[model samples]
Target chain A: MVESLSLPKDLVLGSAILTVTGNSDLYIENYKGILLYEDCCILLQTKTCQVQIEGCNLSIDYYNNEDMRISGCIRQIVWK
Target chain B: MNRIIIWLKGYVKVRLSGFSPERFMNLCGNRSIHVWGVENHGRFYILYMSRKSFLQLRPVIRKTKTKVAIIEKYGLPFFMHRYRKRKLFFAGILVFLMILLVMSLYIWDIRISGNYSKTSDMILKLLSDNNYKYGMRKSKVDCEAIEKLIRAEYNDVTWASARIDGTCLIVELKENEILRQEETVEKPSDLIAEREGEVVAIVTRAGSPKVRKGDMVSANQILVSGAVPVLDDFKTLVGMQYVKADADIYLKTRLPYEYSLPFLHTEKEYTGKKRYDGSISLFSKNLKFHIFDNPFPEFDRVEDTKQIRLSEYFTLPVTVTLRTTSEYRTVKKKYTKEEAAALCKENLKKFLDDLEEKGVQIIENDVKIGIVGENCLAKGMVDVILLMEKRQDTEMVTVTVPEDNRETEE
Candidate 1:
């Protein structure tokens, strides 16, 4: 399931992300559009794009092409 | 261009830069748009184009704007930087006004004071001649040079200085002081009898008594004299007199004049023509003009002149005046012996008449005439001396002790 969640108030979307307790190493994506990355930030087009993540204590990895990866303790998943 | 216009139709505003009024007008070239106005500020150029053309030519104009730095740098931002753009113009106007104010404060007129004999007109002329004149700029006038020139011309000036105060050039002068010689007072001196006769006047100021009036006294004899007395309380053994004495005495003398003449003509002569010139000096240079010249050469000439220096030290020439005189010559005729004698007697009578007017008494007279060298000459001499009486009052101070004081002291 794609877990949808509202961004935390203290979290900056481009610089960091939040993790919930649910899944880990879950493969996911039914993307509506390409999420381009620039300057360590993600640009999501059309608001309907979704992604699934497995982990709680999520570790984020930044890519040279300005993309971000998520891993670690999973708590729950959400989609919107 | 049509495509560019279609592309620009979507935007509400278009900006153009780097185009001056002339250049912009040239570019407009038959484009229908009202020209509002043109504004110039030194090297900066700003042209306003209507929205229609601005949009239509945006692509082409933008290419032009990039080529010109004034456009690319200042064009778009000038509207937002209005204050900075007007600063230079305002500063230039302020500087120009300041210069005008300074120039107006410079001296325009030079006024002199403390001048009596030196006329204002002459002083002004002198100043003008020395390049320190009216309407001359203050910076152009050298005060030292003016002072030197004036001092050189006017000798009576003790000192002179010039200064510029606002629009006035003030020239202050000090005149030289004239010194008068002191006269010496005569001490006690001999007052001798004036003439050989009786003492007529005796006025003793500070001397002992000598002789009284009506006393026969010879010339050089003391009348009211100069001698002081030393006395004892018993009123004895001291004698002296201090007196100023005068006397008038009568004397008789014999003198003769002879005249002889033959009928002969004599020439009468008169003076010659005269001319006078007036001169004034300024800055050591003299300006002179002759006021009068004798018209007749045969006439005798006489000239009179007066000169005064306006300043004592500077010795500036204030004014010089001269008078000229001319006299003509006339012929004279000779007279026979009889006529000569009669003329001599007439002349003698006229002389005696003059002497009578002067209070002289003629006691006796003798006359004679002789012919010599075909001319008649009359000779006569008269002896007469004045007899006059003068009385001079003498002041005598007598100090006497009162009888009551003497008795009381005794």
Candidate 2:
């Protein structure tokens, strides 16, 4: 039914998959870019919105063309 | 797991001291070059990324006008680069790998299972006699031949199988339980005395008693007769009926025991001086460095050896042996008469225990210890009661009765 609307899935149906486990591991799939990187906070760009991750000792464990993993003590996540 | 691949591909710790070092990272990411482990270092920033991505960062470094310098290089590629000029290092690694590859093709261990009364060593010896020992090449070992050889060599083994499992040779055997059935058929036999003894008791189950109680019997004497003589009405013997003899005969016997214990003992005492010898064994060949005599006079040698093993079941035929010979001096020690007597008593107890295990009931033991010269002699006679039986099989004879004799009996 959503395909009948002729809207791109990544833009209209949330193509980005974000998994946060136990406030320690954050896995993001289909991410666009890293807007900001810091020890206490990280801002990532996804398909539909910008993701702001606030944490302590935040570090990007790995990053590739479309996927990224951030690991730290994550306290909150804000999507803009 | 992916990180290990990245590490093997090599990585570099680069310090960017110029303005906006983050731009350098962004530019690297834009060019499809993966970068991770970003850290701030004073006015500079340190980024650890793969070597491939670092090589591709030259254009981005010029664009950002950042000063880039490699602080450290890590991973396998860089490690190899350091040893590139040393030819011996690579040669050693190649030789080691070659040896490992060659050793893995041979059997390093042999394991046997499914044995009840047969020992593992005995089975292993049987295998070794047929070119199936450890360190034999797996390609040369014939599992079927080994199985057939084991079955033919041991009558107890009914079924056998030999196979190679990884670097170990596994052998399994099933023993024949029905091999003892041929001796169970009853035949005409007589129970005879196996040893000289006085008759203690007689319990005849299927035979006539040949000797009564307290009768002195010699070896090979018939204790029970299997023949039953048939008689006529006039007390005339007509024929004989023979059957298998079955009886338990208990006898009283005497066994002599003699043991001697020395009073003066010469023992070796360590003098705290030692000599060492070392050797290398490769493929059953020993390369020894002659530093001292192999066997030192008045000295004991302790040997320690280590073999090269790749896994639990895979071992190479290379061993290093270290032998340490410690010097000693002869010391004369004197044992008290009581101590010698106690030692003799301990030995006699063990002998008595052995006799009891063989179903001999001890009736009386008279042992005496005496000091003869520098030695203590224990002389005695043990009286034991035991059951002795020896069977001789005979064919049953058929006898025909005449019609006149049958009519006379009627």
Candidate 3:
């Protein structure tokens, strides 16, 4: 019914969102928690699955309860 | 802006050592602790959090079994704490700002514009006489009142306006271009000869003619009379009427000119030796301090002074003067005959040009230059046709006339 009404899936289903800006920065929204932090990789648990981000010199620019912004030379992002 | 706010609130860079640093961050996120700029060094994790959040991190650190230590403290709280011992420097900055604020409350500069017939010095003198001058409190100055005062004091000023803009008092003025209208409505007077000369031309604008062309008149002789004799039907003098006398009377006169120049004169010549020095002066307080030394026997000191000002209108009392002293020696110079004659002719031409500039027509020049002994003398008379303005009060007369003969024609 929501799909027939053309409602946005991210807002209706409450799924985690990953926004990439160019090749330098990434913004993650509605994430559950930070799972692991390292210089080359960062893992996060979202509502549906675990999200992993692999990068060089990866650092969190800012983070609050609902969202986090990461900035570095990003290599890849995977969801499992 | 958010970063500035965080810096203002103060923050600390914390280093977490032990297991599960990620859990520590997750616990901090759940507890509503704001953290940012997180980096990892394999053995420990480093992150930044607000000073208040760091105080509430005991439970999160204990839960994750991570030992945390503040590696670096940042922001305003730490800055103020570090400079807590140098209280005088901070106090000096506050006092300087207070002085600037106080100074802005009073006027420092006054500027007058758009005046041609009346000089700016005249208007400035009037303003100072009426207690409106530099250093006066700005609130006490009423712009409308100043406008009214300026218009009332100056008869030629047609429009006047005064305003205060950022410690500067500006006065704008417009003057009447018809400046000679007062002569037509002036008191009854007679036009007299200002110099002993033969009358060349006369144009009567208001008065009755007392002298004609080619009439030789002495100084103080009446050239035109303000009184007019009224005639009756029989062409007999009945009474006299008075009006202001105005006329253009040109006089042909001889102006005696004599100039003497010494053939041998002492002139100072520069020796190319110069000394540069400076001084600081407080003109408002009449205090001057100079640092200079001149070893030359004879020198000319040229000093240039400049006032300290933040802008055109925000001038201060401090002045800096740079003094330049150039050494010189006097030498005796002898003039040749041709040089003396040429110099004499140039001076005579300059004199004639000056007379022409003053509206005096140069009719003829009969100057002769002769070098006598050690001096060059130029003596001659210049014929000039000059219009003179001189007046005397007309005498009031009493006359008896018949009632029927009292017909007035103006």
Candidate 4:
């Protein structure tokens, strides 16, 4: 029914919303799962795309099912 | 505000050394455990999670075969846990707070205001003897009783009031300096002119008005006379009755003044170097510590002092005093005759303003300013009108004659 109304998935279906502040703070909302996690890289799976965050010292400030806050010296973020 | 919320919810930083720490974190997330502050250090994953979630991570740790070590603990729960052993110390703090609260309910200080002739110590002693001393509970203070007691003991206090202001007891008093003298002896009086002048206006509220508007009155003339003649039919001579005459009479009079001002004046011109000195004053003594010397020979100093009050009507002994000084060079300023005359006119205007404030109406002003040698001389004469009242109490004397003289007059 939501898809028939033709509303944005992120707004109607509560899909993933990613926000980055400066080069040190990264926040993700409505994420589905985490695929790859390492010292310098983190991979987050959303309903529609994959969020690849590459940083020097990537660390998760906080993470739950609804929202997550990642803090480190972020070098790049890619959506695929 | 956010920090307070975070402090209430205890958190801890944990270092996880396992094959797949992210999987362990995901399991924890699935179980509704909120995790934060994840950092990568080689193979070990450092993360922060709430203290509640950290305790519930045993199953996840076992499943992932990870080594968990708490790096740091944060928030109030941990604080309470750390100080749980010091039960006596916490009890001592609680007792101290209770004592402070209880002490604040009583009077800690007393202040007196509006007192003259009678010393404050006498009033304090009077209050202490009447059970209104310091440390007395504010709720127990009988304000009306204390005021009455002070008034009765002093006899000179016209009015008195005692009130509790914060932690201080404030005693307000008004002293009667005149002590109700011969003024209470009422006598029939008349309002008379103090000096000779033309009457401008007359408003009589009591008795008969002897003078009208624009009437030229003489010195010591009765403007409102107290003596009123009571007569019967046929216009015969009758008895004289007296009354207290009250009236407002405005008179037209002239006031003259002369002033001389020098053309050259000495004025201080600021050089823009300013210094501020601050001191803490305790009990009227200023304690100042300064490491710098006065760099200028000539300067202007302005001192301002304010008392530090703990509450309204409760001033503490300590005060912060701040003084600012500006360096200036004294220079001789040469003024033109017009400028000097302007200065003199300003002075004259100020004098006239003062007179106007005292109910004087300026009718005409004849003023002249001119250069007399190097100084400017200003001469002015202002005609002003104001109400003047003067009266004296006198006993009415009766004249008695001898029997032969009385018979002859009859």
Candidate 5:
């Protein structure tokens, strides 16, 4: 039904959209809340699963009600 | 861009010490209170939030029971609140900006360049007469009109351009390579002999040659005649055609020269004594002070003054003058025979150099420098070759027509 209407899944089905630029920056939209935030790693929860970003020197540049930006040397992005 | 907005609205760097600062941040975020630059300290967390967000932090603080301490407050709203008592300082700033704004609306400097035959001061005077001068309104200045005015006033100016850059009005012009000789009509005159001399050579440009080469012409004799006789088809003189005579007539002549100098002369011998006086002048008023008195009757005084200025075009009415006085004694001195002869030769050489500068050729020097009774005398007769260009108006000729000739023509 969403594809028939030609709408993005993140906007229609309430799914999270993760945009990573190289190994340094990550942008998350349609996320539920921040499960954990540390200098080394950041864990965010979405509608269906929790997205875990593993990196070194990880820090949140800024966060608001709609999206969040994480920047550092990212090593892994595990979904659970 | 977001940082500027945050700064304008004011922000606080908060240090949360109690447990669950992350939960507090999450609650604040869910409620639409934006926070950024979140850093995790070992036992505490530090973050930045706007003033409005900090107000909503109270409810979040109570729910999470986290103690948030404002480490620093920054930006324009807080700065204004802290300096609310200094009204005069702010008013002075506003007045300064207003003055600067008013100053920028007028032209302050006028510069002219590329003018050679015409001086900058003369051009500036012309511009002032035409209302295009320093301190004129920028909006009233028309660059094209200025160019046209300069070209119109100076017939010799071949090209002109005017432009306004910032507050400076720049006008540049180029003068014609050749003088406006074509615009002026030459007077009808004859080239007469300047002096009684033998003609060495003659070159005619616009007139009939009256004296040939090697001809001995008398003083005031015509070298080139301005009235050229017109000839008909049968080679009969019909009338006289008048024209300005132009020609080069080189003549060989002799000139007399004499110079003398006194044997005894008074010379100055400077003594080893000096005095200096310093003074400062302000706004056309000067108060001079010196501690030393004049010790000698005959002394030379030299003054040097320097004016102070703030910028290239802005001058301050302040100057400093320094005066130096040196004592000198006059003594009678007699020139030796050799020195007197050398001095006469040096002066004679200088005179010849001056003549050479004026395109005159010196063929010989028979001058004699000898010490006479009580003085040195230099006398001679020098031979020279020079050009003559003495002109006088040409007398017109009238032809009387007979009554029978006039009736046949009618």
Candidate 6:
């Protein structure tokens, strides 16, 4: 039911596959998996939540409640 | 409202909430709101708001819409007040200057023209005596009175007038032209017989004689001579002689007399008196009153005459005197023959005495007397002649006969 959800045109979600399991190993596309694993965080990658950051730099931290930081010259933020 | 009114006065627009204070704050979540306040009274206030806010809160503020006037700085009332304040001082000064100018234009000096013998000082003295003088207003000087005074004092003046020229009083005088004297001498003069009487006396100062005394000479006969011979002494020369002669002759004459007496007597006296006032006009329109009438019943008659003499400036004339002659009737006595005779003799003697006093030498006389009707009238005629000696000294001129020249001519 969540996969069939629709949002308005001002919001958008990215297409990336990810599985959520106990102690799963996931390799992020823009960042090295070791950097995420060293942070003692779970790598739960999903195509729905995966976002391709353009003209921006991305960071993920497991200890800060799945907080992802975006930096660089960002033009806009969209949620769909 | 006061703020809005002030803003309007300064060319500004104001906006404010349009509702009760409490309701407006409650509607706005108890927040403070900025409003344009206008003091309508000591206790009440008016608010002005933008169009949008007014429309949104129309139902609330519509009941509070109190129309007010806003005056601009350059409006009629502002300019009118300023102009009134500025003109007050200038208007007062203008009025004061006008009054001063008029006062300065009054008569300052009296000027006289057309006067040769009568001086300006004389005219001024006359004018001053009659209430006209320097620094007097033009309206104050009585022109007719002055003219009358000038005419009365100056007889040679034919006319006089006065006027105001600028700040000076101009007086005009007209002097009368003097009349020429007439000559009464004639040429080739002769002493004619003034009366048809005998040559009682004759005296010739010049010319030759044509008659002698004691000879029968008629009227107009040349008794004394006017023609004379122009001659030199001790020579046949021409000379002039003035002759005189006198003669005594008799004459017969008649006389008559008549006298009338009033049968009744009548008398009259004046019972009424009249008064007169005089005035003169100068320059055709100026009028002046000079005399006031005083009444008297004792006067027999009243006469007044006015003479108008016209000239360039003044009109002058003599006041012709009008007089009244009173007459009355009374009784007179008649004269008898003896009285009339005596009167006639006395008159004749007086006449002869008068002639003797006038250098007439009466040499002889023949007289007669007569009576007529109830009166004794004297008819006396006399040939009383006299002599006037022509004793003029003659100057003799001698001419020497040259003996050698006569012998040479022979």
The model with the greatest lDDT is 3
Give the candidate number with the greatest TM-score.
2
Error of 4 at B342 (Å): 1.4
Expressed as tens digits, the lDDT of each residue in B134-191 for candidate 5 is 6678899999998999999999999999987766788999988667565456767999
lDDT of each candidate versus the true structure: 0.49, 0.83, 0.87, 0.80, 0.84, 0.44
Q: Give me the runs in candidate 2 sitting further than 4 Å from their true place.
A: A1-32, A46-52, A65-67, A71-80, B1-4, B16-32, B59-67, B95-260, B281-286, B302-322, B336-410
TM-score for chain A, candidates 1 onward in order: 0.30, 0.83, 0.91, 0.82, 0.92, 0.25
Deviation in Å, model 6, residue B128 alpha carbon: 27
Candidate 3 lDDT tens digits, A1-80: 87899998678876898999986999999899999899989999998899999989999998878899999989999998
Clash pairs, candidate 2, are none
Please estimate how well model 2 matches the true structure, expressed as its whole-model Cα lDDT. Answer: 0.83
Model 1 TM-score? Answer: 0.29
Query: What is the Å distance of residue B302 in model 2 from its true position?
Result: 4.7
DockQ (C-alpha based) per candidate is 0.00, 0.28, 0.65, 0.53, 0.50, 0.00
Off by over 4 Å in 3: A1-80, B1-102, B113-133, B139-160, B172-185, B273-283, B293-303, B322-327, B395-410
TM-score, one value per model: 0.29, 0.64, 0.55, 0.55, 0.52, 0.26
lDDT of 1 by residue, B156-263 (tens): 777889877665678887766561111123233445544565444444445554666567666655554433555557755334443433334343333344444456
For every candidate structure, what is the RMSD over all alpha carbons to the true structure, in angstroms? 33.9, 6.9, 9.4, 9.7, 10.7, 44.0
Winner of 1 and 6 under lDDT? 1
lDDT of 3 at B51: 96
Which residue segments of model 5 deviate by more than 4 Å?
A1-80, B1-109, B114-119, B131-142, B152-158, B164-168, B175-179, B268-332, B399-410
Rank the models by TM-score, top first: 2, 3, 4, 5, 1, 6
For residues A1-80, could you state the per-residue lDDT of candidate 6 as single tens digits?
A: 33467653223443332222222222233221111111122222333442332222222211111222322333332222
Q: Write the per-residue lDDT of candidate 4 for residues A1-80, one digit (tens) a residue.
A: 77789888788766788788999988899887778787688998888888899987777777887788888889999889
Worst 10 residues of 6 chain B by lDDT: B179-188
